[model samples]
Structure formats: structure tokens, C-alpha cells
Target: MAYELYYWDGIQGRGEFVRLALEEAGAEYIDITRESGRGRGTGAMLAIMQSDGEALPPFAPPFLKDGDLIISHVANILLYLGPKLGLVPDDEALRYVVNGLQLTITDFVAEVHDTHHPIATSLYYEDQKEEAKARSAAFIKERIPKFLGYFEKVLNQNPEGSDYIVGNALTYVDLSLFQIVEGLVYAFPKAMSNYRGSYPLLAALRDRVERRPNITHYLRSDRRLAFNTEGIFRHYPELDIGVS
Candidate 1:
């Protein structure tokens, strides 16, 4: 049976990470909210969410329905699908390591969201523009280097090789790292202009992932949504700060 991926229709949001994995693996899945047909679309997803019969309801979108099992959260969904999709290592110990990396990515993504919505998600960006500028400045000055540098270090110290983040083989974590770098560039081009120089290994990995046949095809296809302000990585010219 095809996996049913439930995520908001318009924006990539947290759903893009899961999409990257499914795309890279060439897995058969349905982007539930994006389709228009019987048993598809956002309403079908919300019905499942609002259903009282669902004992284990997900708090938000980006959840995956596989057979009778429903997996929520980006990391949890990836963990569940990784082995099956051949996007994770066979080694038991290495799987945990990759999960840790993914959780760290989750942390980084939350921080990225906070840059634009520092005060509250309920408030509009215009309402909290000043606070966002401050938050984004600090994020660009300190957080970006801290997180990206750590990943670079991880790549540098990997016993397997610097080609991939964890093991020698490609994993979902690598695909996620590609998404992270891509989003960062979209949201803060000036700030990330030196990313190639600062994080050579990661830059190389991003290039490698982009050159992959499946990823290349996805990038050119309509399925790959363009980055926009409505999405998590919004580019408000005012919020961006160049690297100091």
C-alpha cells in the first residue's frame, strides 16, 4: 500500500524533510493534502485528526499513515521509514546516531522559525518586526555558526569519511542537511554567502545530494515547491544580516 503523507498543502514547512527522504528513496507515497480526489486533500487529513476514534492523534501535519500505523513528527516519521526506505544504516548502533543528528536538525529548524516569529507565532511578522530583526541578527551572528560549525565538525571527524554525516553510506540525515542548507540560503542569502568557505564539507555534501539522479529530477519537477515567504524560511530583506 502507498504511504499517506499528511502535511499542509501550501508550504513546505516541516513536511519538506520527510518529502526529501521519500523522494531520494524513490518510495511510493501520496502527498495527501496536495492531491484533489476522493479520500485525498486537506479535509481528509483533518478528518483523521478531528476523529475521536483515533487513539493516537498527531498534534500537527507532516505525519505519515502506513498501513494501520500513523507516525507523527519529522524525526519519528523518518525513523520509522528509514530502514524500510533504505535511507538509514543497517547497523543498530548507527541508527541511533542518525536519529540524534535528525533531532539536532529539529532543534536548528525550531531556531530558524523563531528568527522570524521570535515573540509569538500568533503575532504577525510586521507586529514583531523589531524583535525579529534582533533575533535574526543574533541567530546569524552566533547560532548559524554554532550549528553549521558543529555539523562541519561532525563531517570532519566521521570515521567513515567526510562524504556523509554519519556512516560511509548515504542516509536520511544527509538529505535533511541538504534541505537545511538550501533553506538557509533562501532565507538569508547574504548571511550564507560564505557558507561554501566556512563549511566546505557540508557544501560538498549539498552539491553531491543535488547531483543525485532522483534529487535532480525532483528539483526540476513540479513536485518540488519553491521557497517562499509563506514557508518557514521566509526572506524578508530587512531580517537578513550579512556575516560579520
Candidate 2:
């Protein structure tokens, strides 16, 4: 059966990572929220925040429904799907390394999210705009370089060369990295522009992922949504230094 993906319908957010892997692997799946009349939209997503379902239901969206299993957490979902989707290696050690990298990406993602919502996720960006401004400044100056620097180090240290993160093959980790760079660039254009040149392997990897046949098609198709403030990576000019 085709996997059923449940996420807020609009803006890629965390869902796009899963979507990208699925698209790249040519896997069959249904984006539930975008199925015309079925599934929830932003309203439903907000309702879920207060509903009892929040406790037991998939914690945060980009959840996957396959058969009887309902899985949440983007990294966990990727871990489960990686091997199933042929996006991970077979060796146990390699798998562990890939997962480790994926978890690091998760940390990086959380940091990125915190840049815009440093004070509180419950508070509006406007209410926390001052904190965000400070946090974003640190992120652009310190955090971005640190995270990107770590990834660059990984690439340089990889025994398999810089073409891929794990071994010589492409894994879900690589895909997630591509998404990170894309999201960062989208959310912090000025910061990214200034520092992206330092990570050539990452830049090349991002370009290659986008050029994948399925990803290319998806980018041109209606399934892809533009980034907006409603999502995790919001672009508030006041918070961003270079976006005028």
C-alpha cells in the first residue's frame, strides 16, 4: 500500500524532507492534507495542538501512516523509511553512522527553528521579535558557521570522499543535508550567501539533489509550496539583516 503522509497542508516545513526522500526514491505515497477534501489544513493542525491527540498522536506532523503503524518525528520517520526506501546502507555500522548524522541534522534543524522562535514557540514572532533579533544575530554569526563547519569537517573526513555523507553512496542523511542548506538559504539568505562558499561539497550536494529527476519534476509541479511565515522558517525582514 502507498504510504500516507499527514502534515499541515501548506509550506514544506519538516514535511518536505520526507517528501524529498520519497520523491527521490520514486516511492508511492499520498500527502493526506493536500487530498482536496480530506485530511486537515492549518485549522486542523492548530486544533490538534490543543486536542488530547497531541499527547499520544504523532508528536508534531510530517507523520507517516503505513498499514497499522503511525509514525511521527521527522528523523524517526526517516530512520524507519531509509532502509525500506533504499536510502540507507545495509551494514549495521554504516546504518548507525547514517542515523547519527541524521540526528545531528535534527539538532541543526532545531537550532534553525530556534533562531526564529528563541524565546518561546507559544509566543508570536512579533511578541518575541527582540529575542529573535538577538538570537538570529548569533545564529548568523556563530551558529551557522559552527553547524556548517561541522558538516564540512564530516565531508572532509569521510573515507569515501565528499560526494556523499556516508560511504560512497547517497543516503537519507545526504537528502536531509540538502534540505538543510535549502531551508537555511531560504530563511537566511544574507547569512547563507556570505558563508555558503565555504562548504563546496554541501553546495554541490544540494545542487545534485535538486537536479534529481523526481525532485526536478516536483519543484515544477503544484505539490511544492513556497516558504512562508506560517511555517517553521519564517522570513521577517526585521529579524533578518539582509532581506530588505
Overall local distance difference test of candidate 1: 0.95
Highest lDDT against the true fold, candidate: 1
- Whole-model lDDT, candidate 2? 0.81
Q: Runs in model 2 with CA error above 4 Å? A: 38-56, 242-244
lDDT tens digits, residue span 1-244, model 2: 9997878887788898898889888899988777655544555544554577545665578788789687888888998999889999878789888988888888888888898899888898788888889999888778888988898889888887888888888898888888888778788777677555688878888888788788899889898898888886777766666522
Structural similarity to truth (TM-score) of each candidate: 0.99, 0.90
Whole-model lDDT per candidate: 0.95, 0.81
Q: Considering every candidate listed, which one attains the maximal TM-score?
A: 1
Q: Candidate 1 on 9-110: residue-level lDDT in tens?
A: 888899999999999999999999999988899999998888999998888888999999999999999999999999888899999999999999999999
After superposition of all CA atoms, the RMSD between model 2 and the true structure is 2.9
State the displacement of the C-alpha of residue 56, model 2, in Å, after optimal TM-score superposition: 4.9
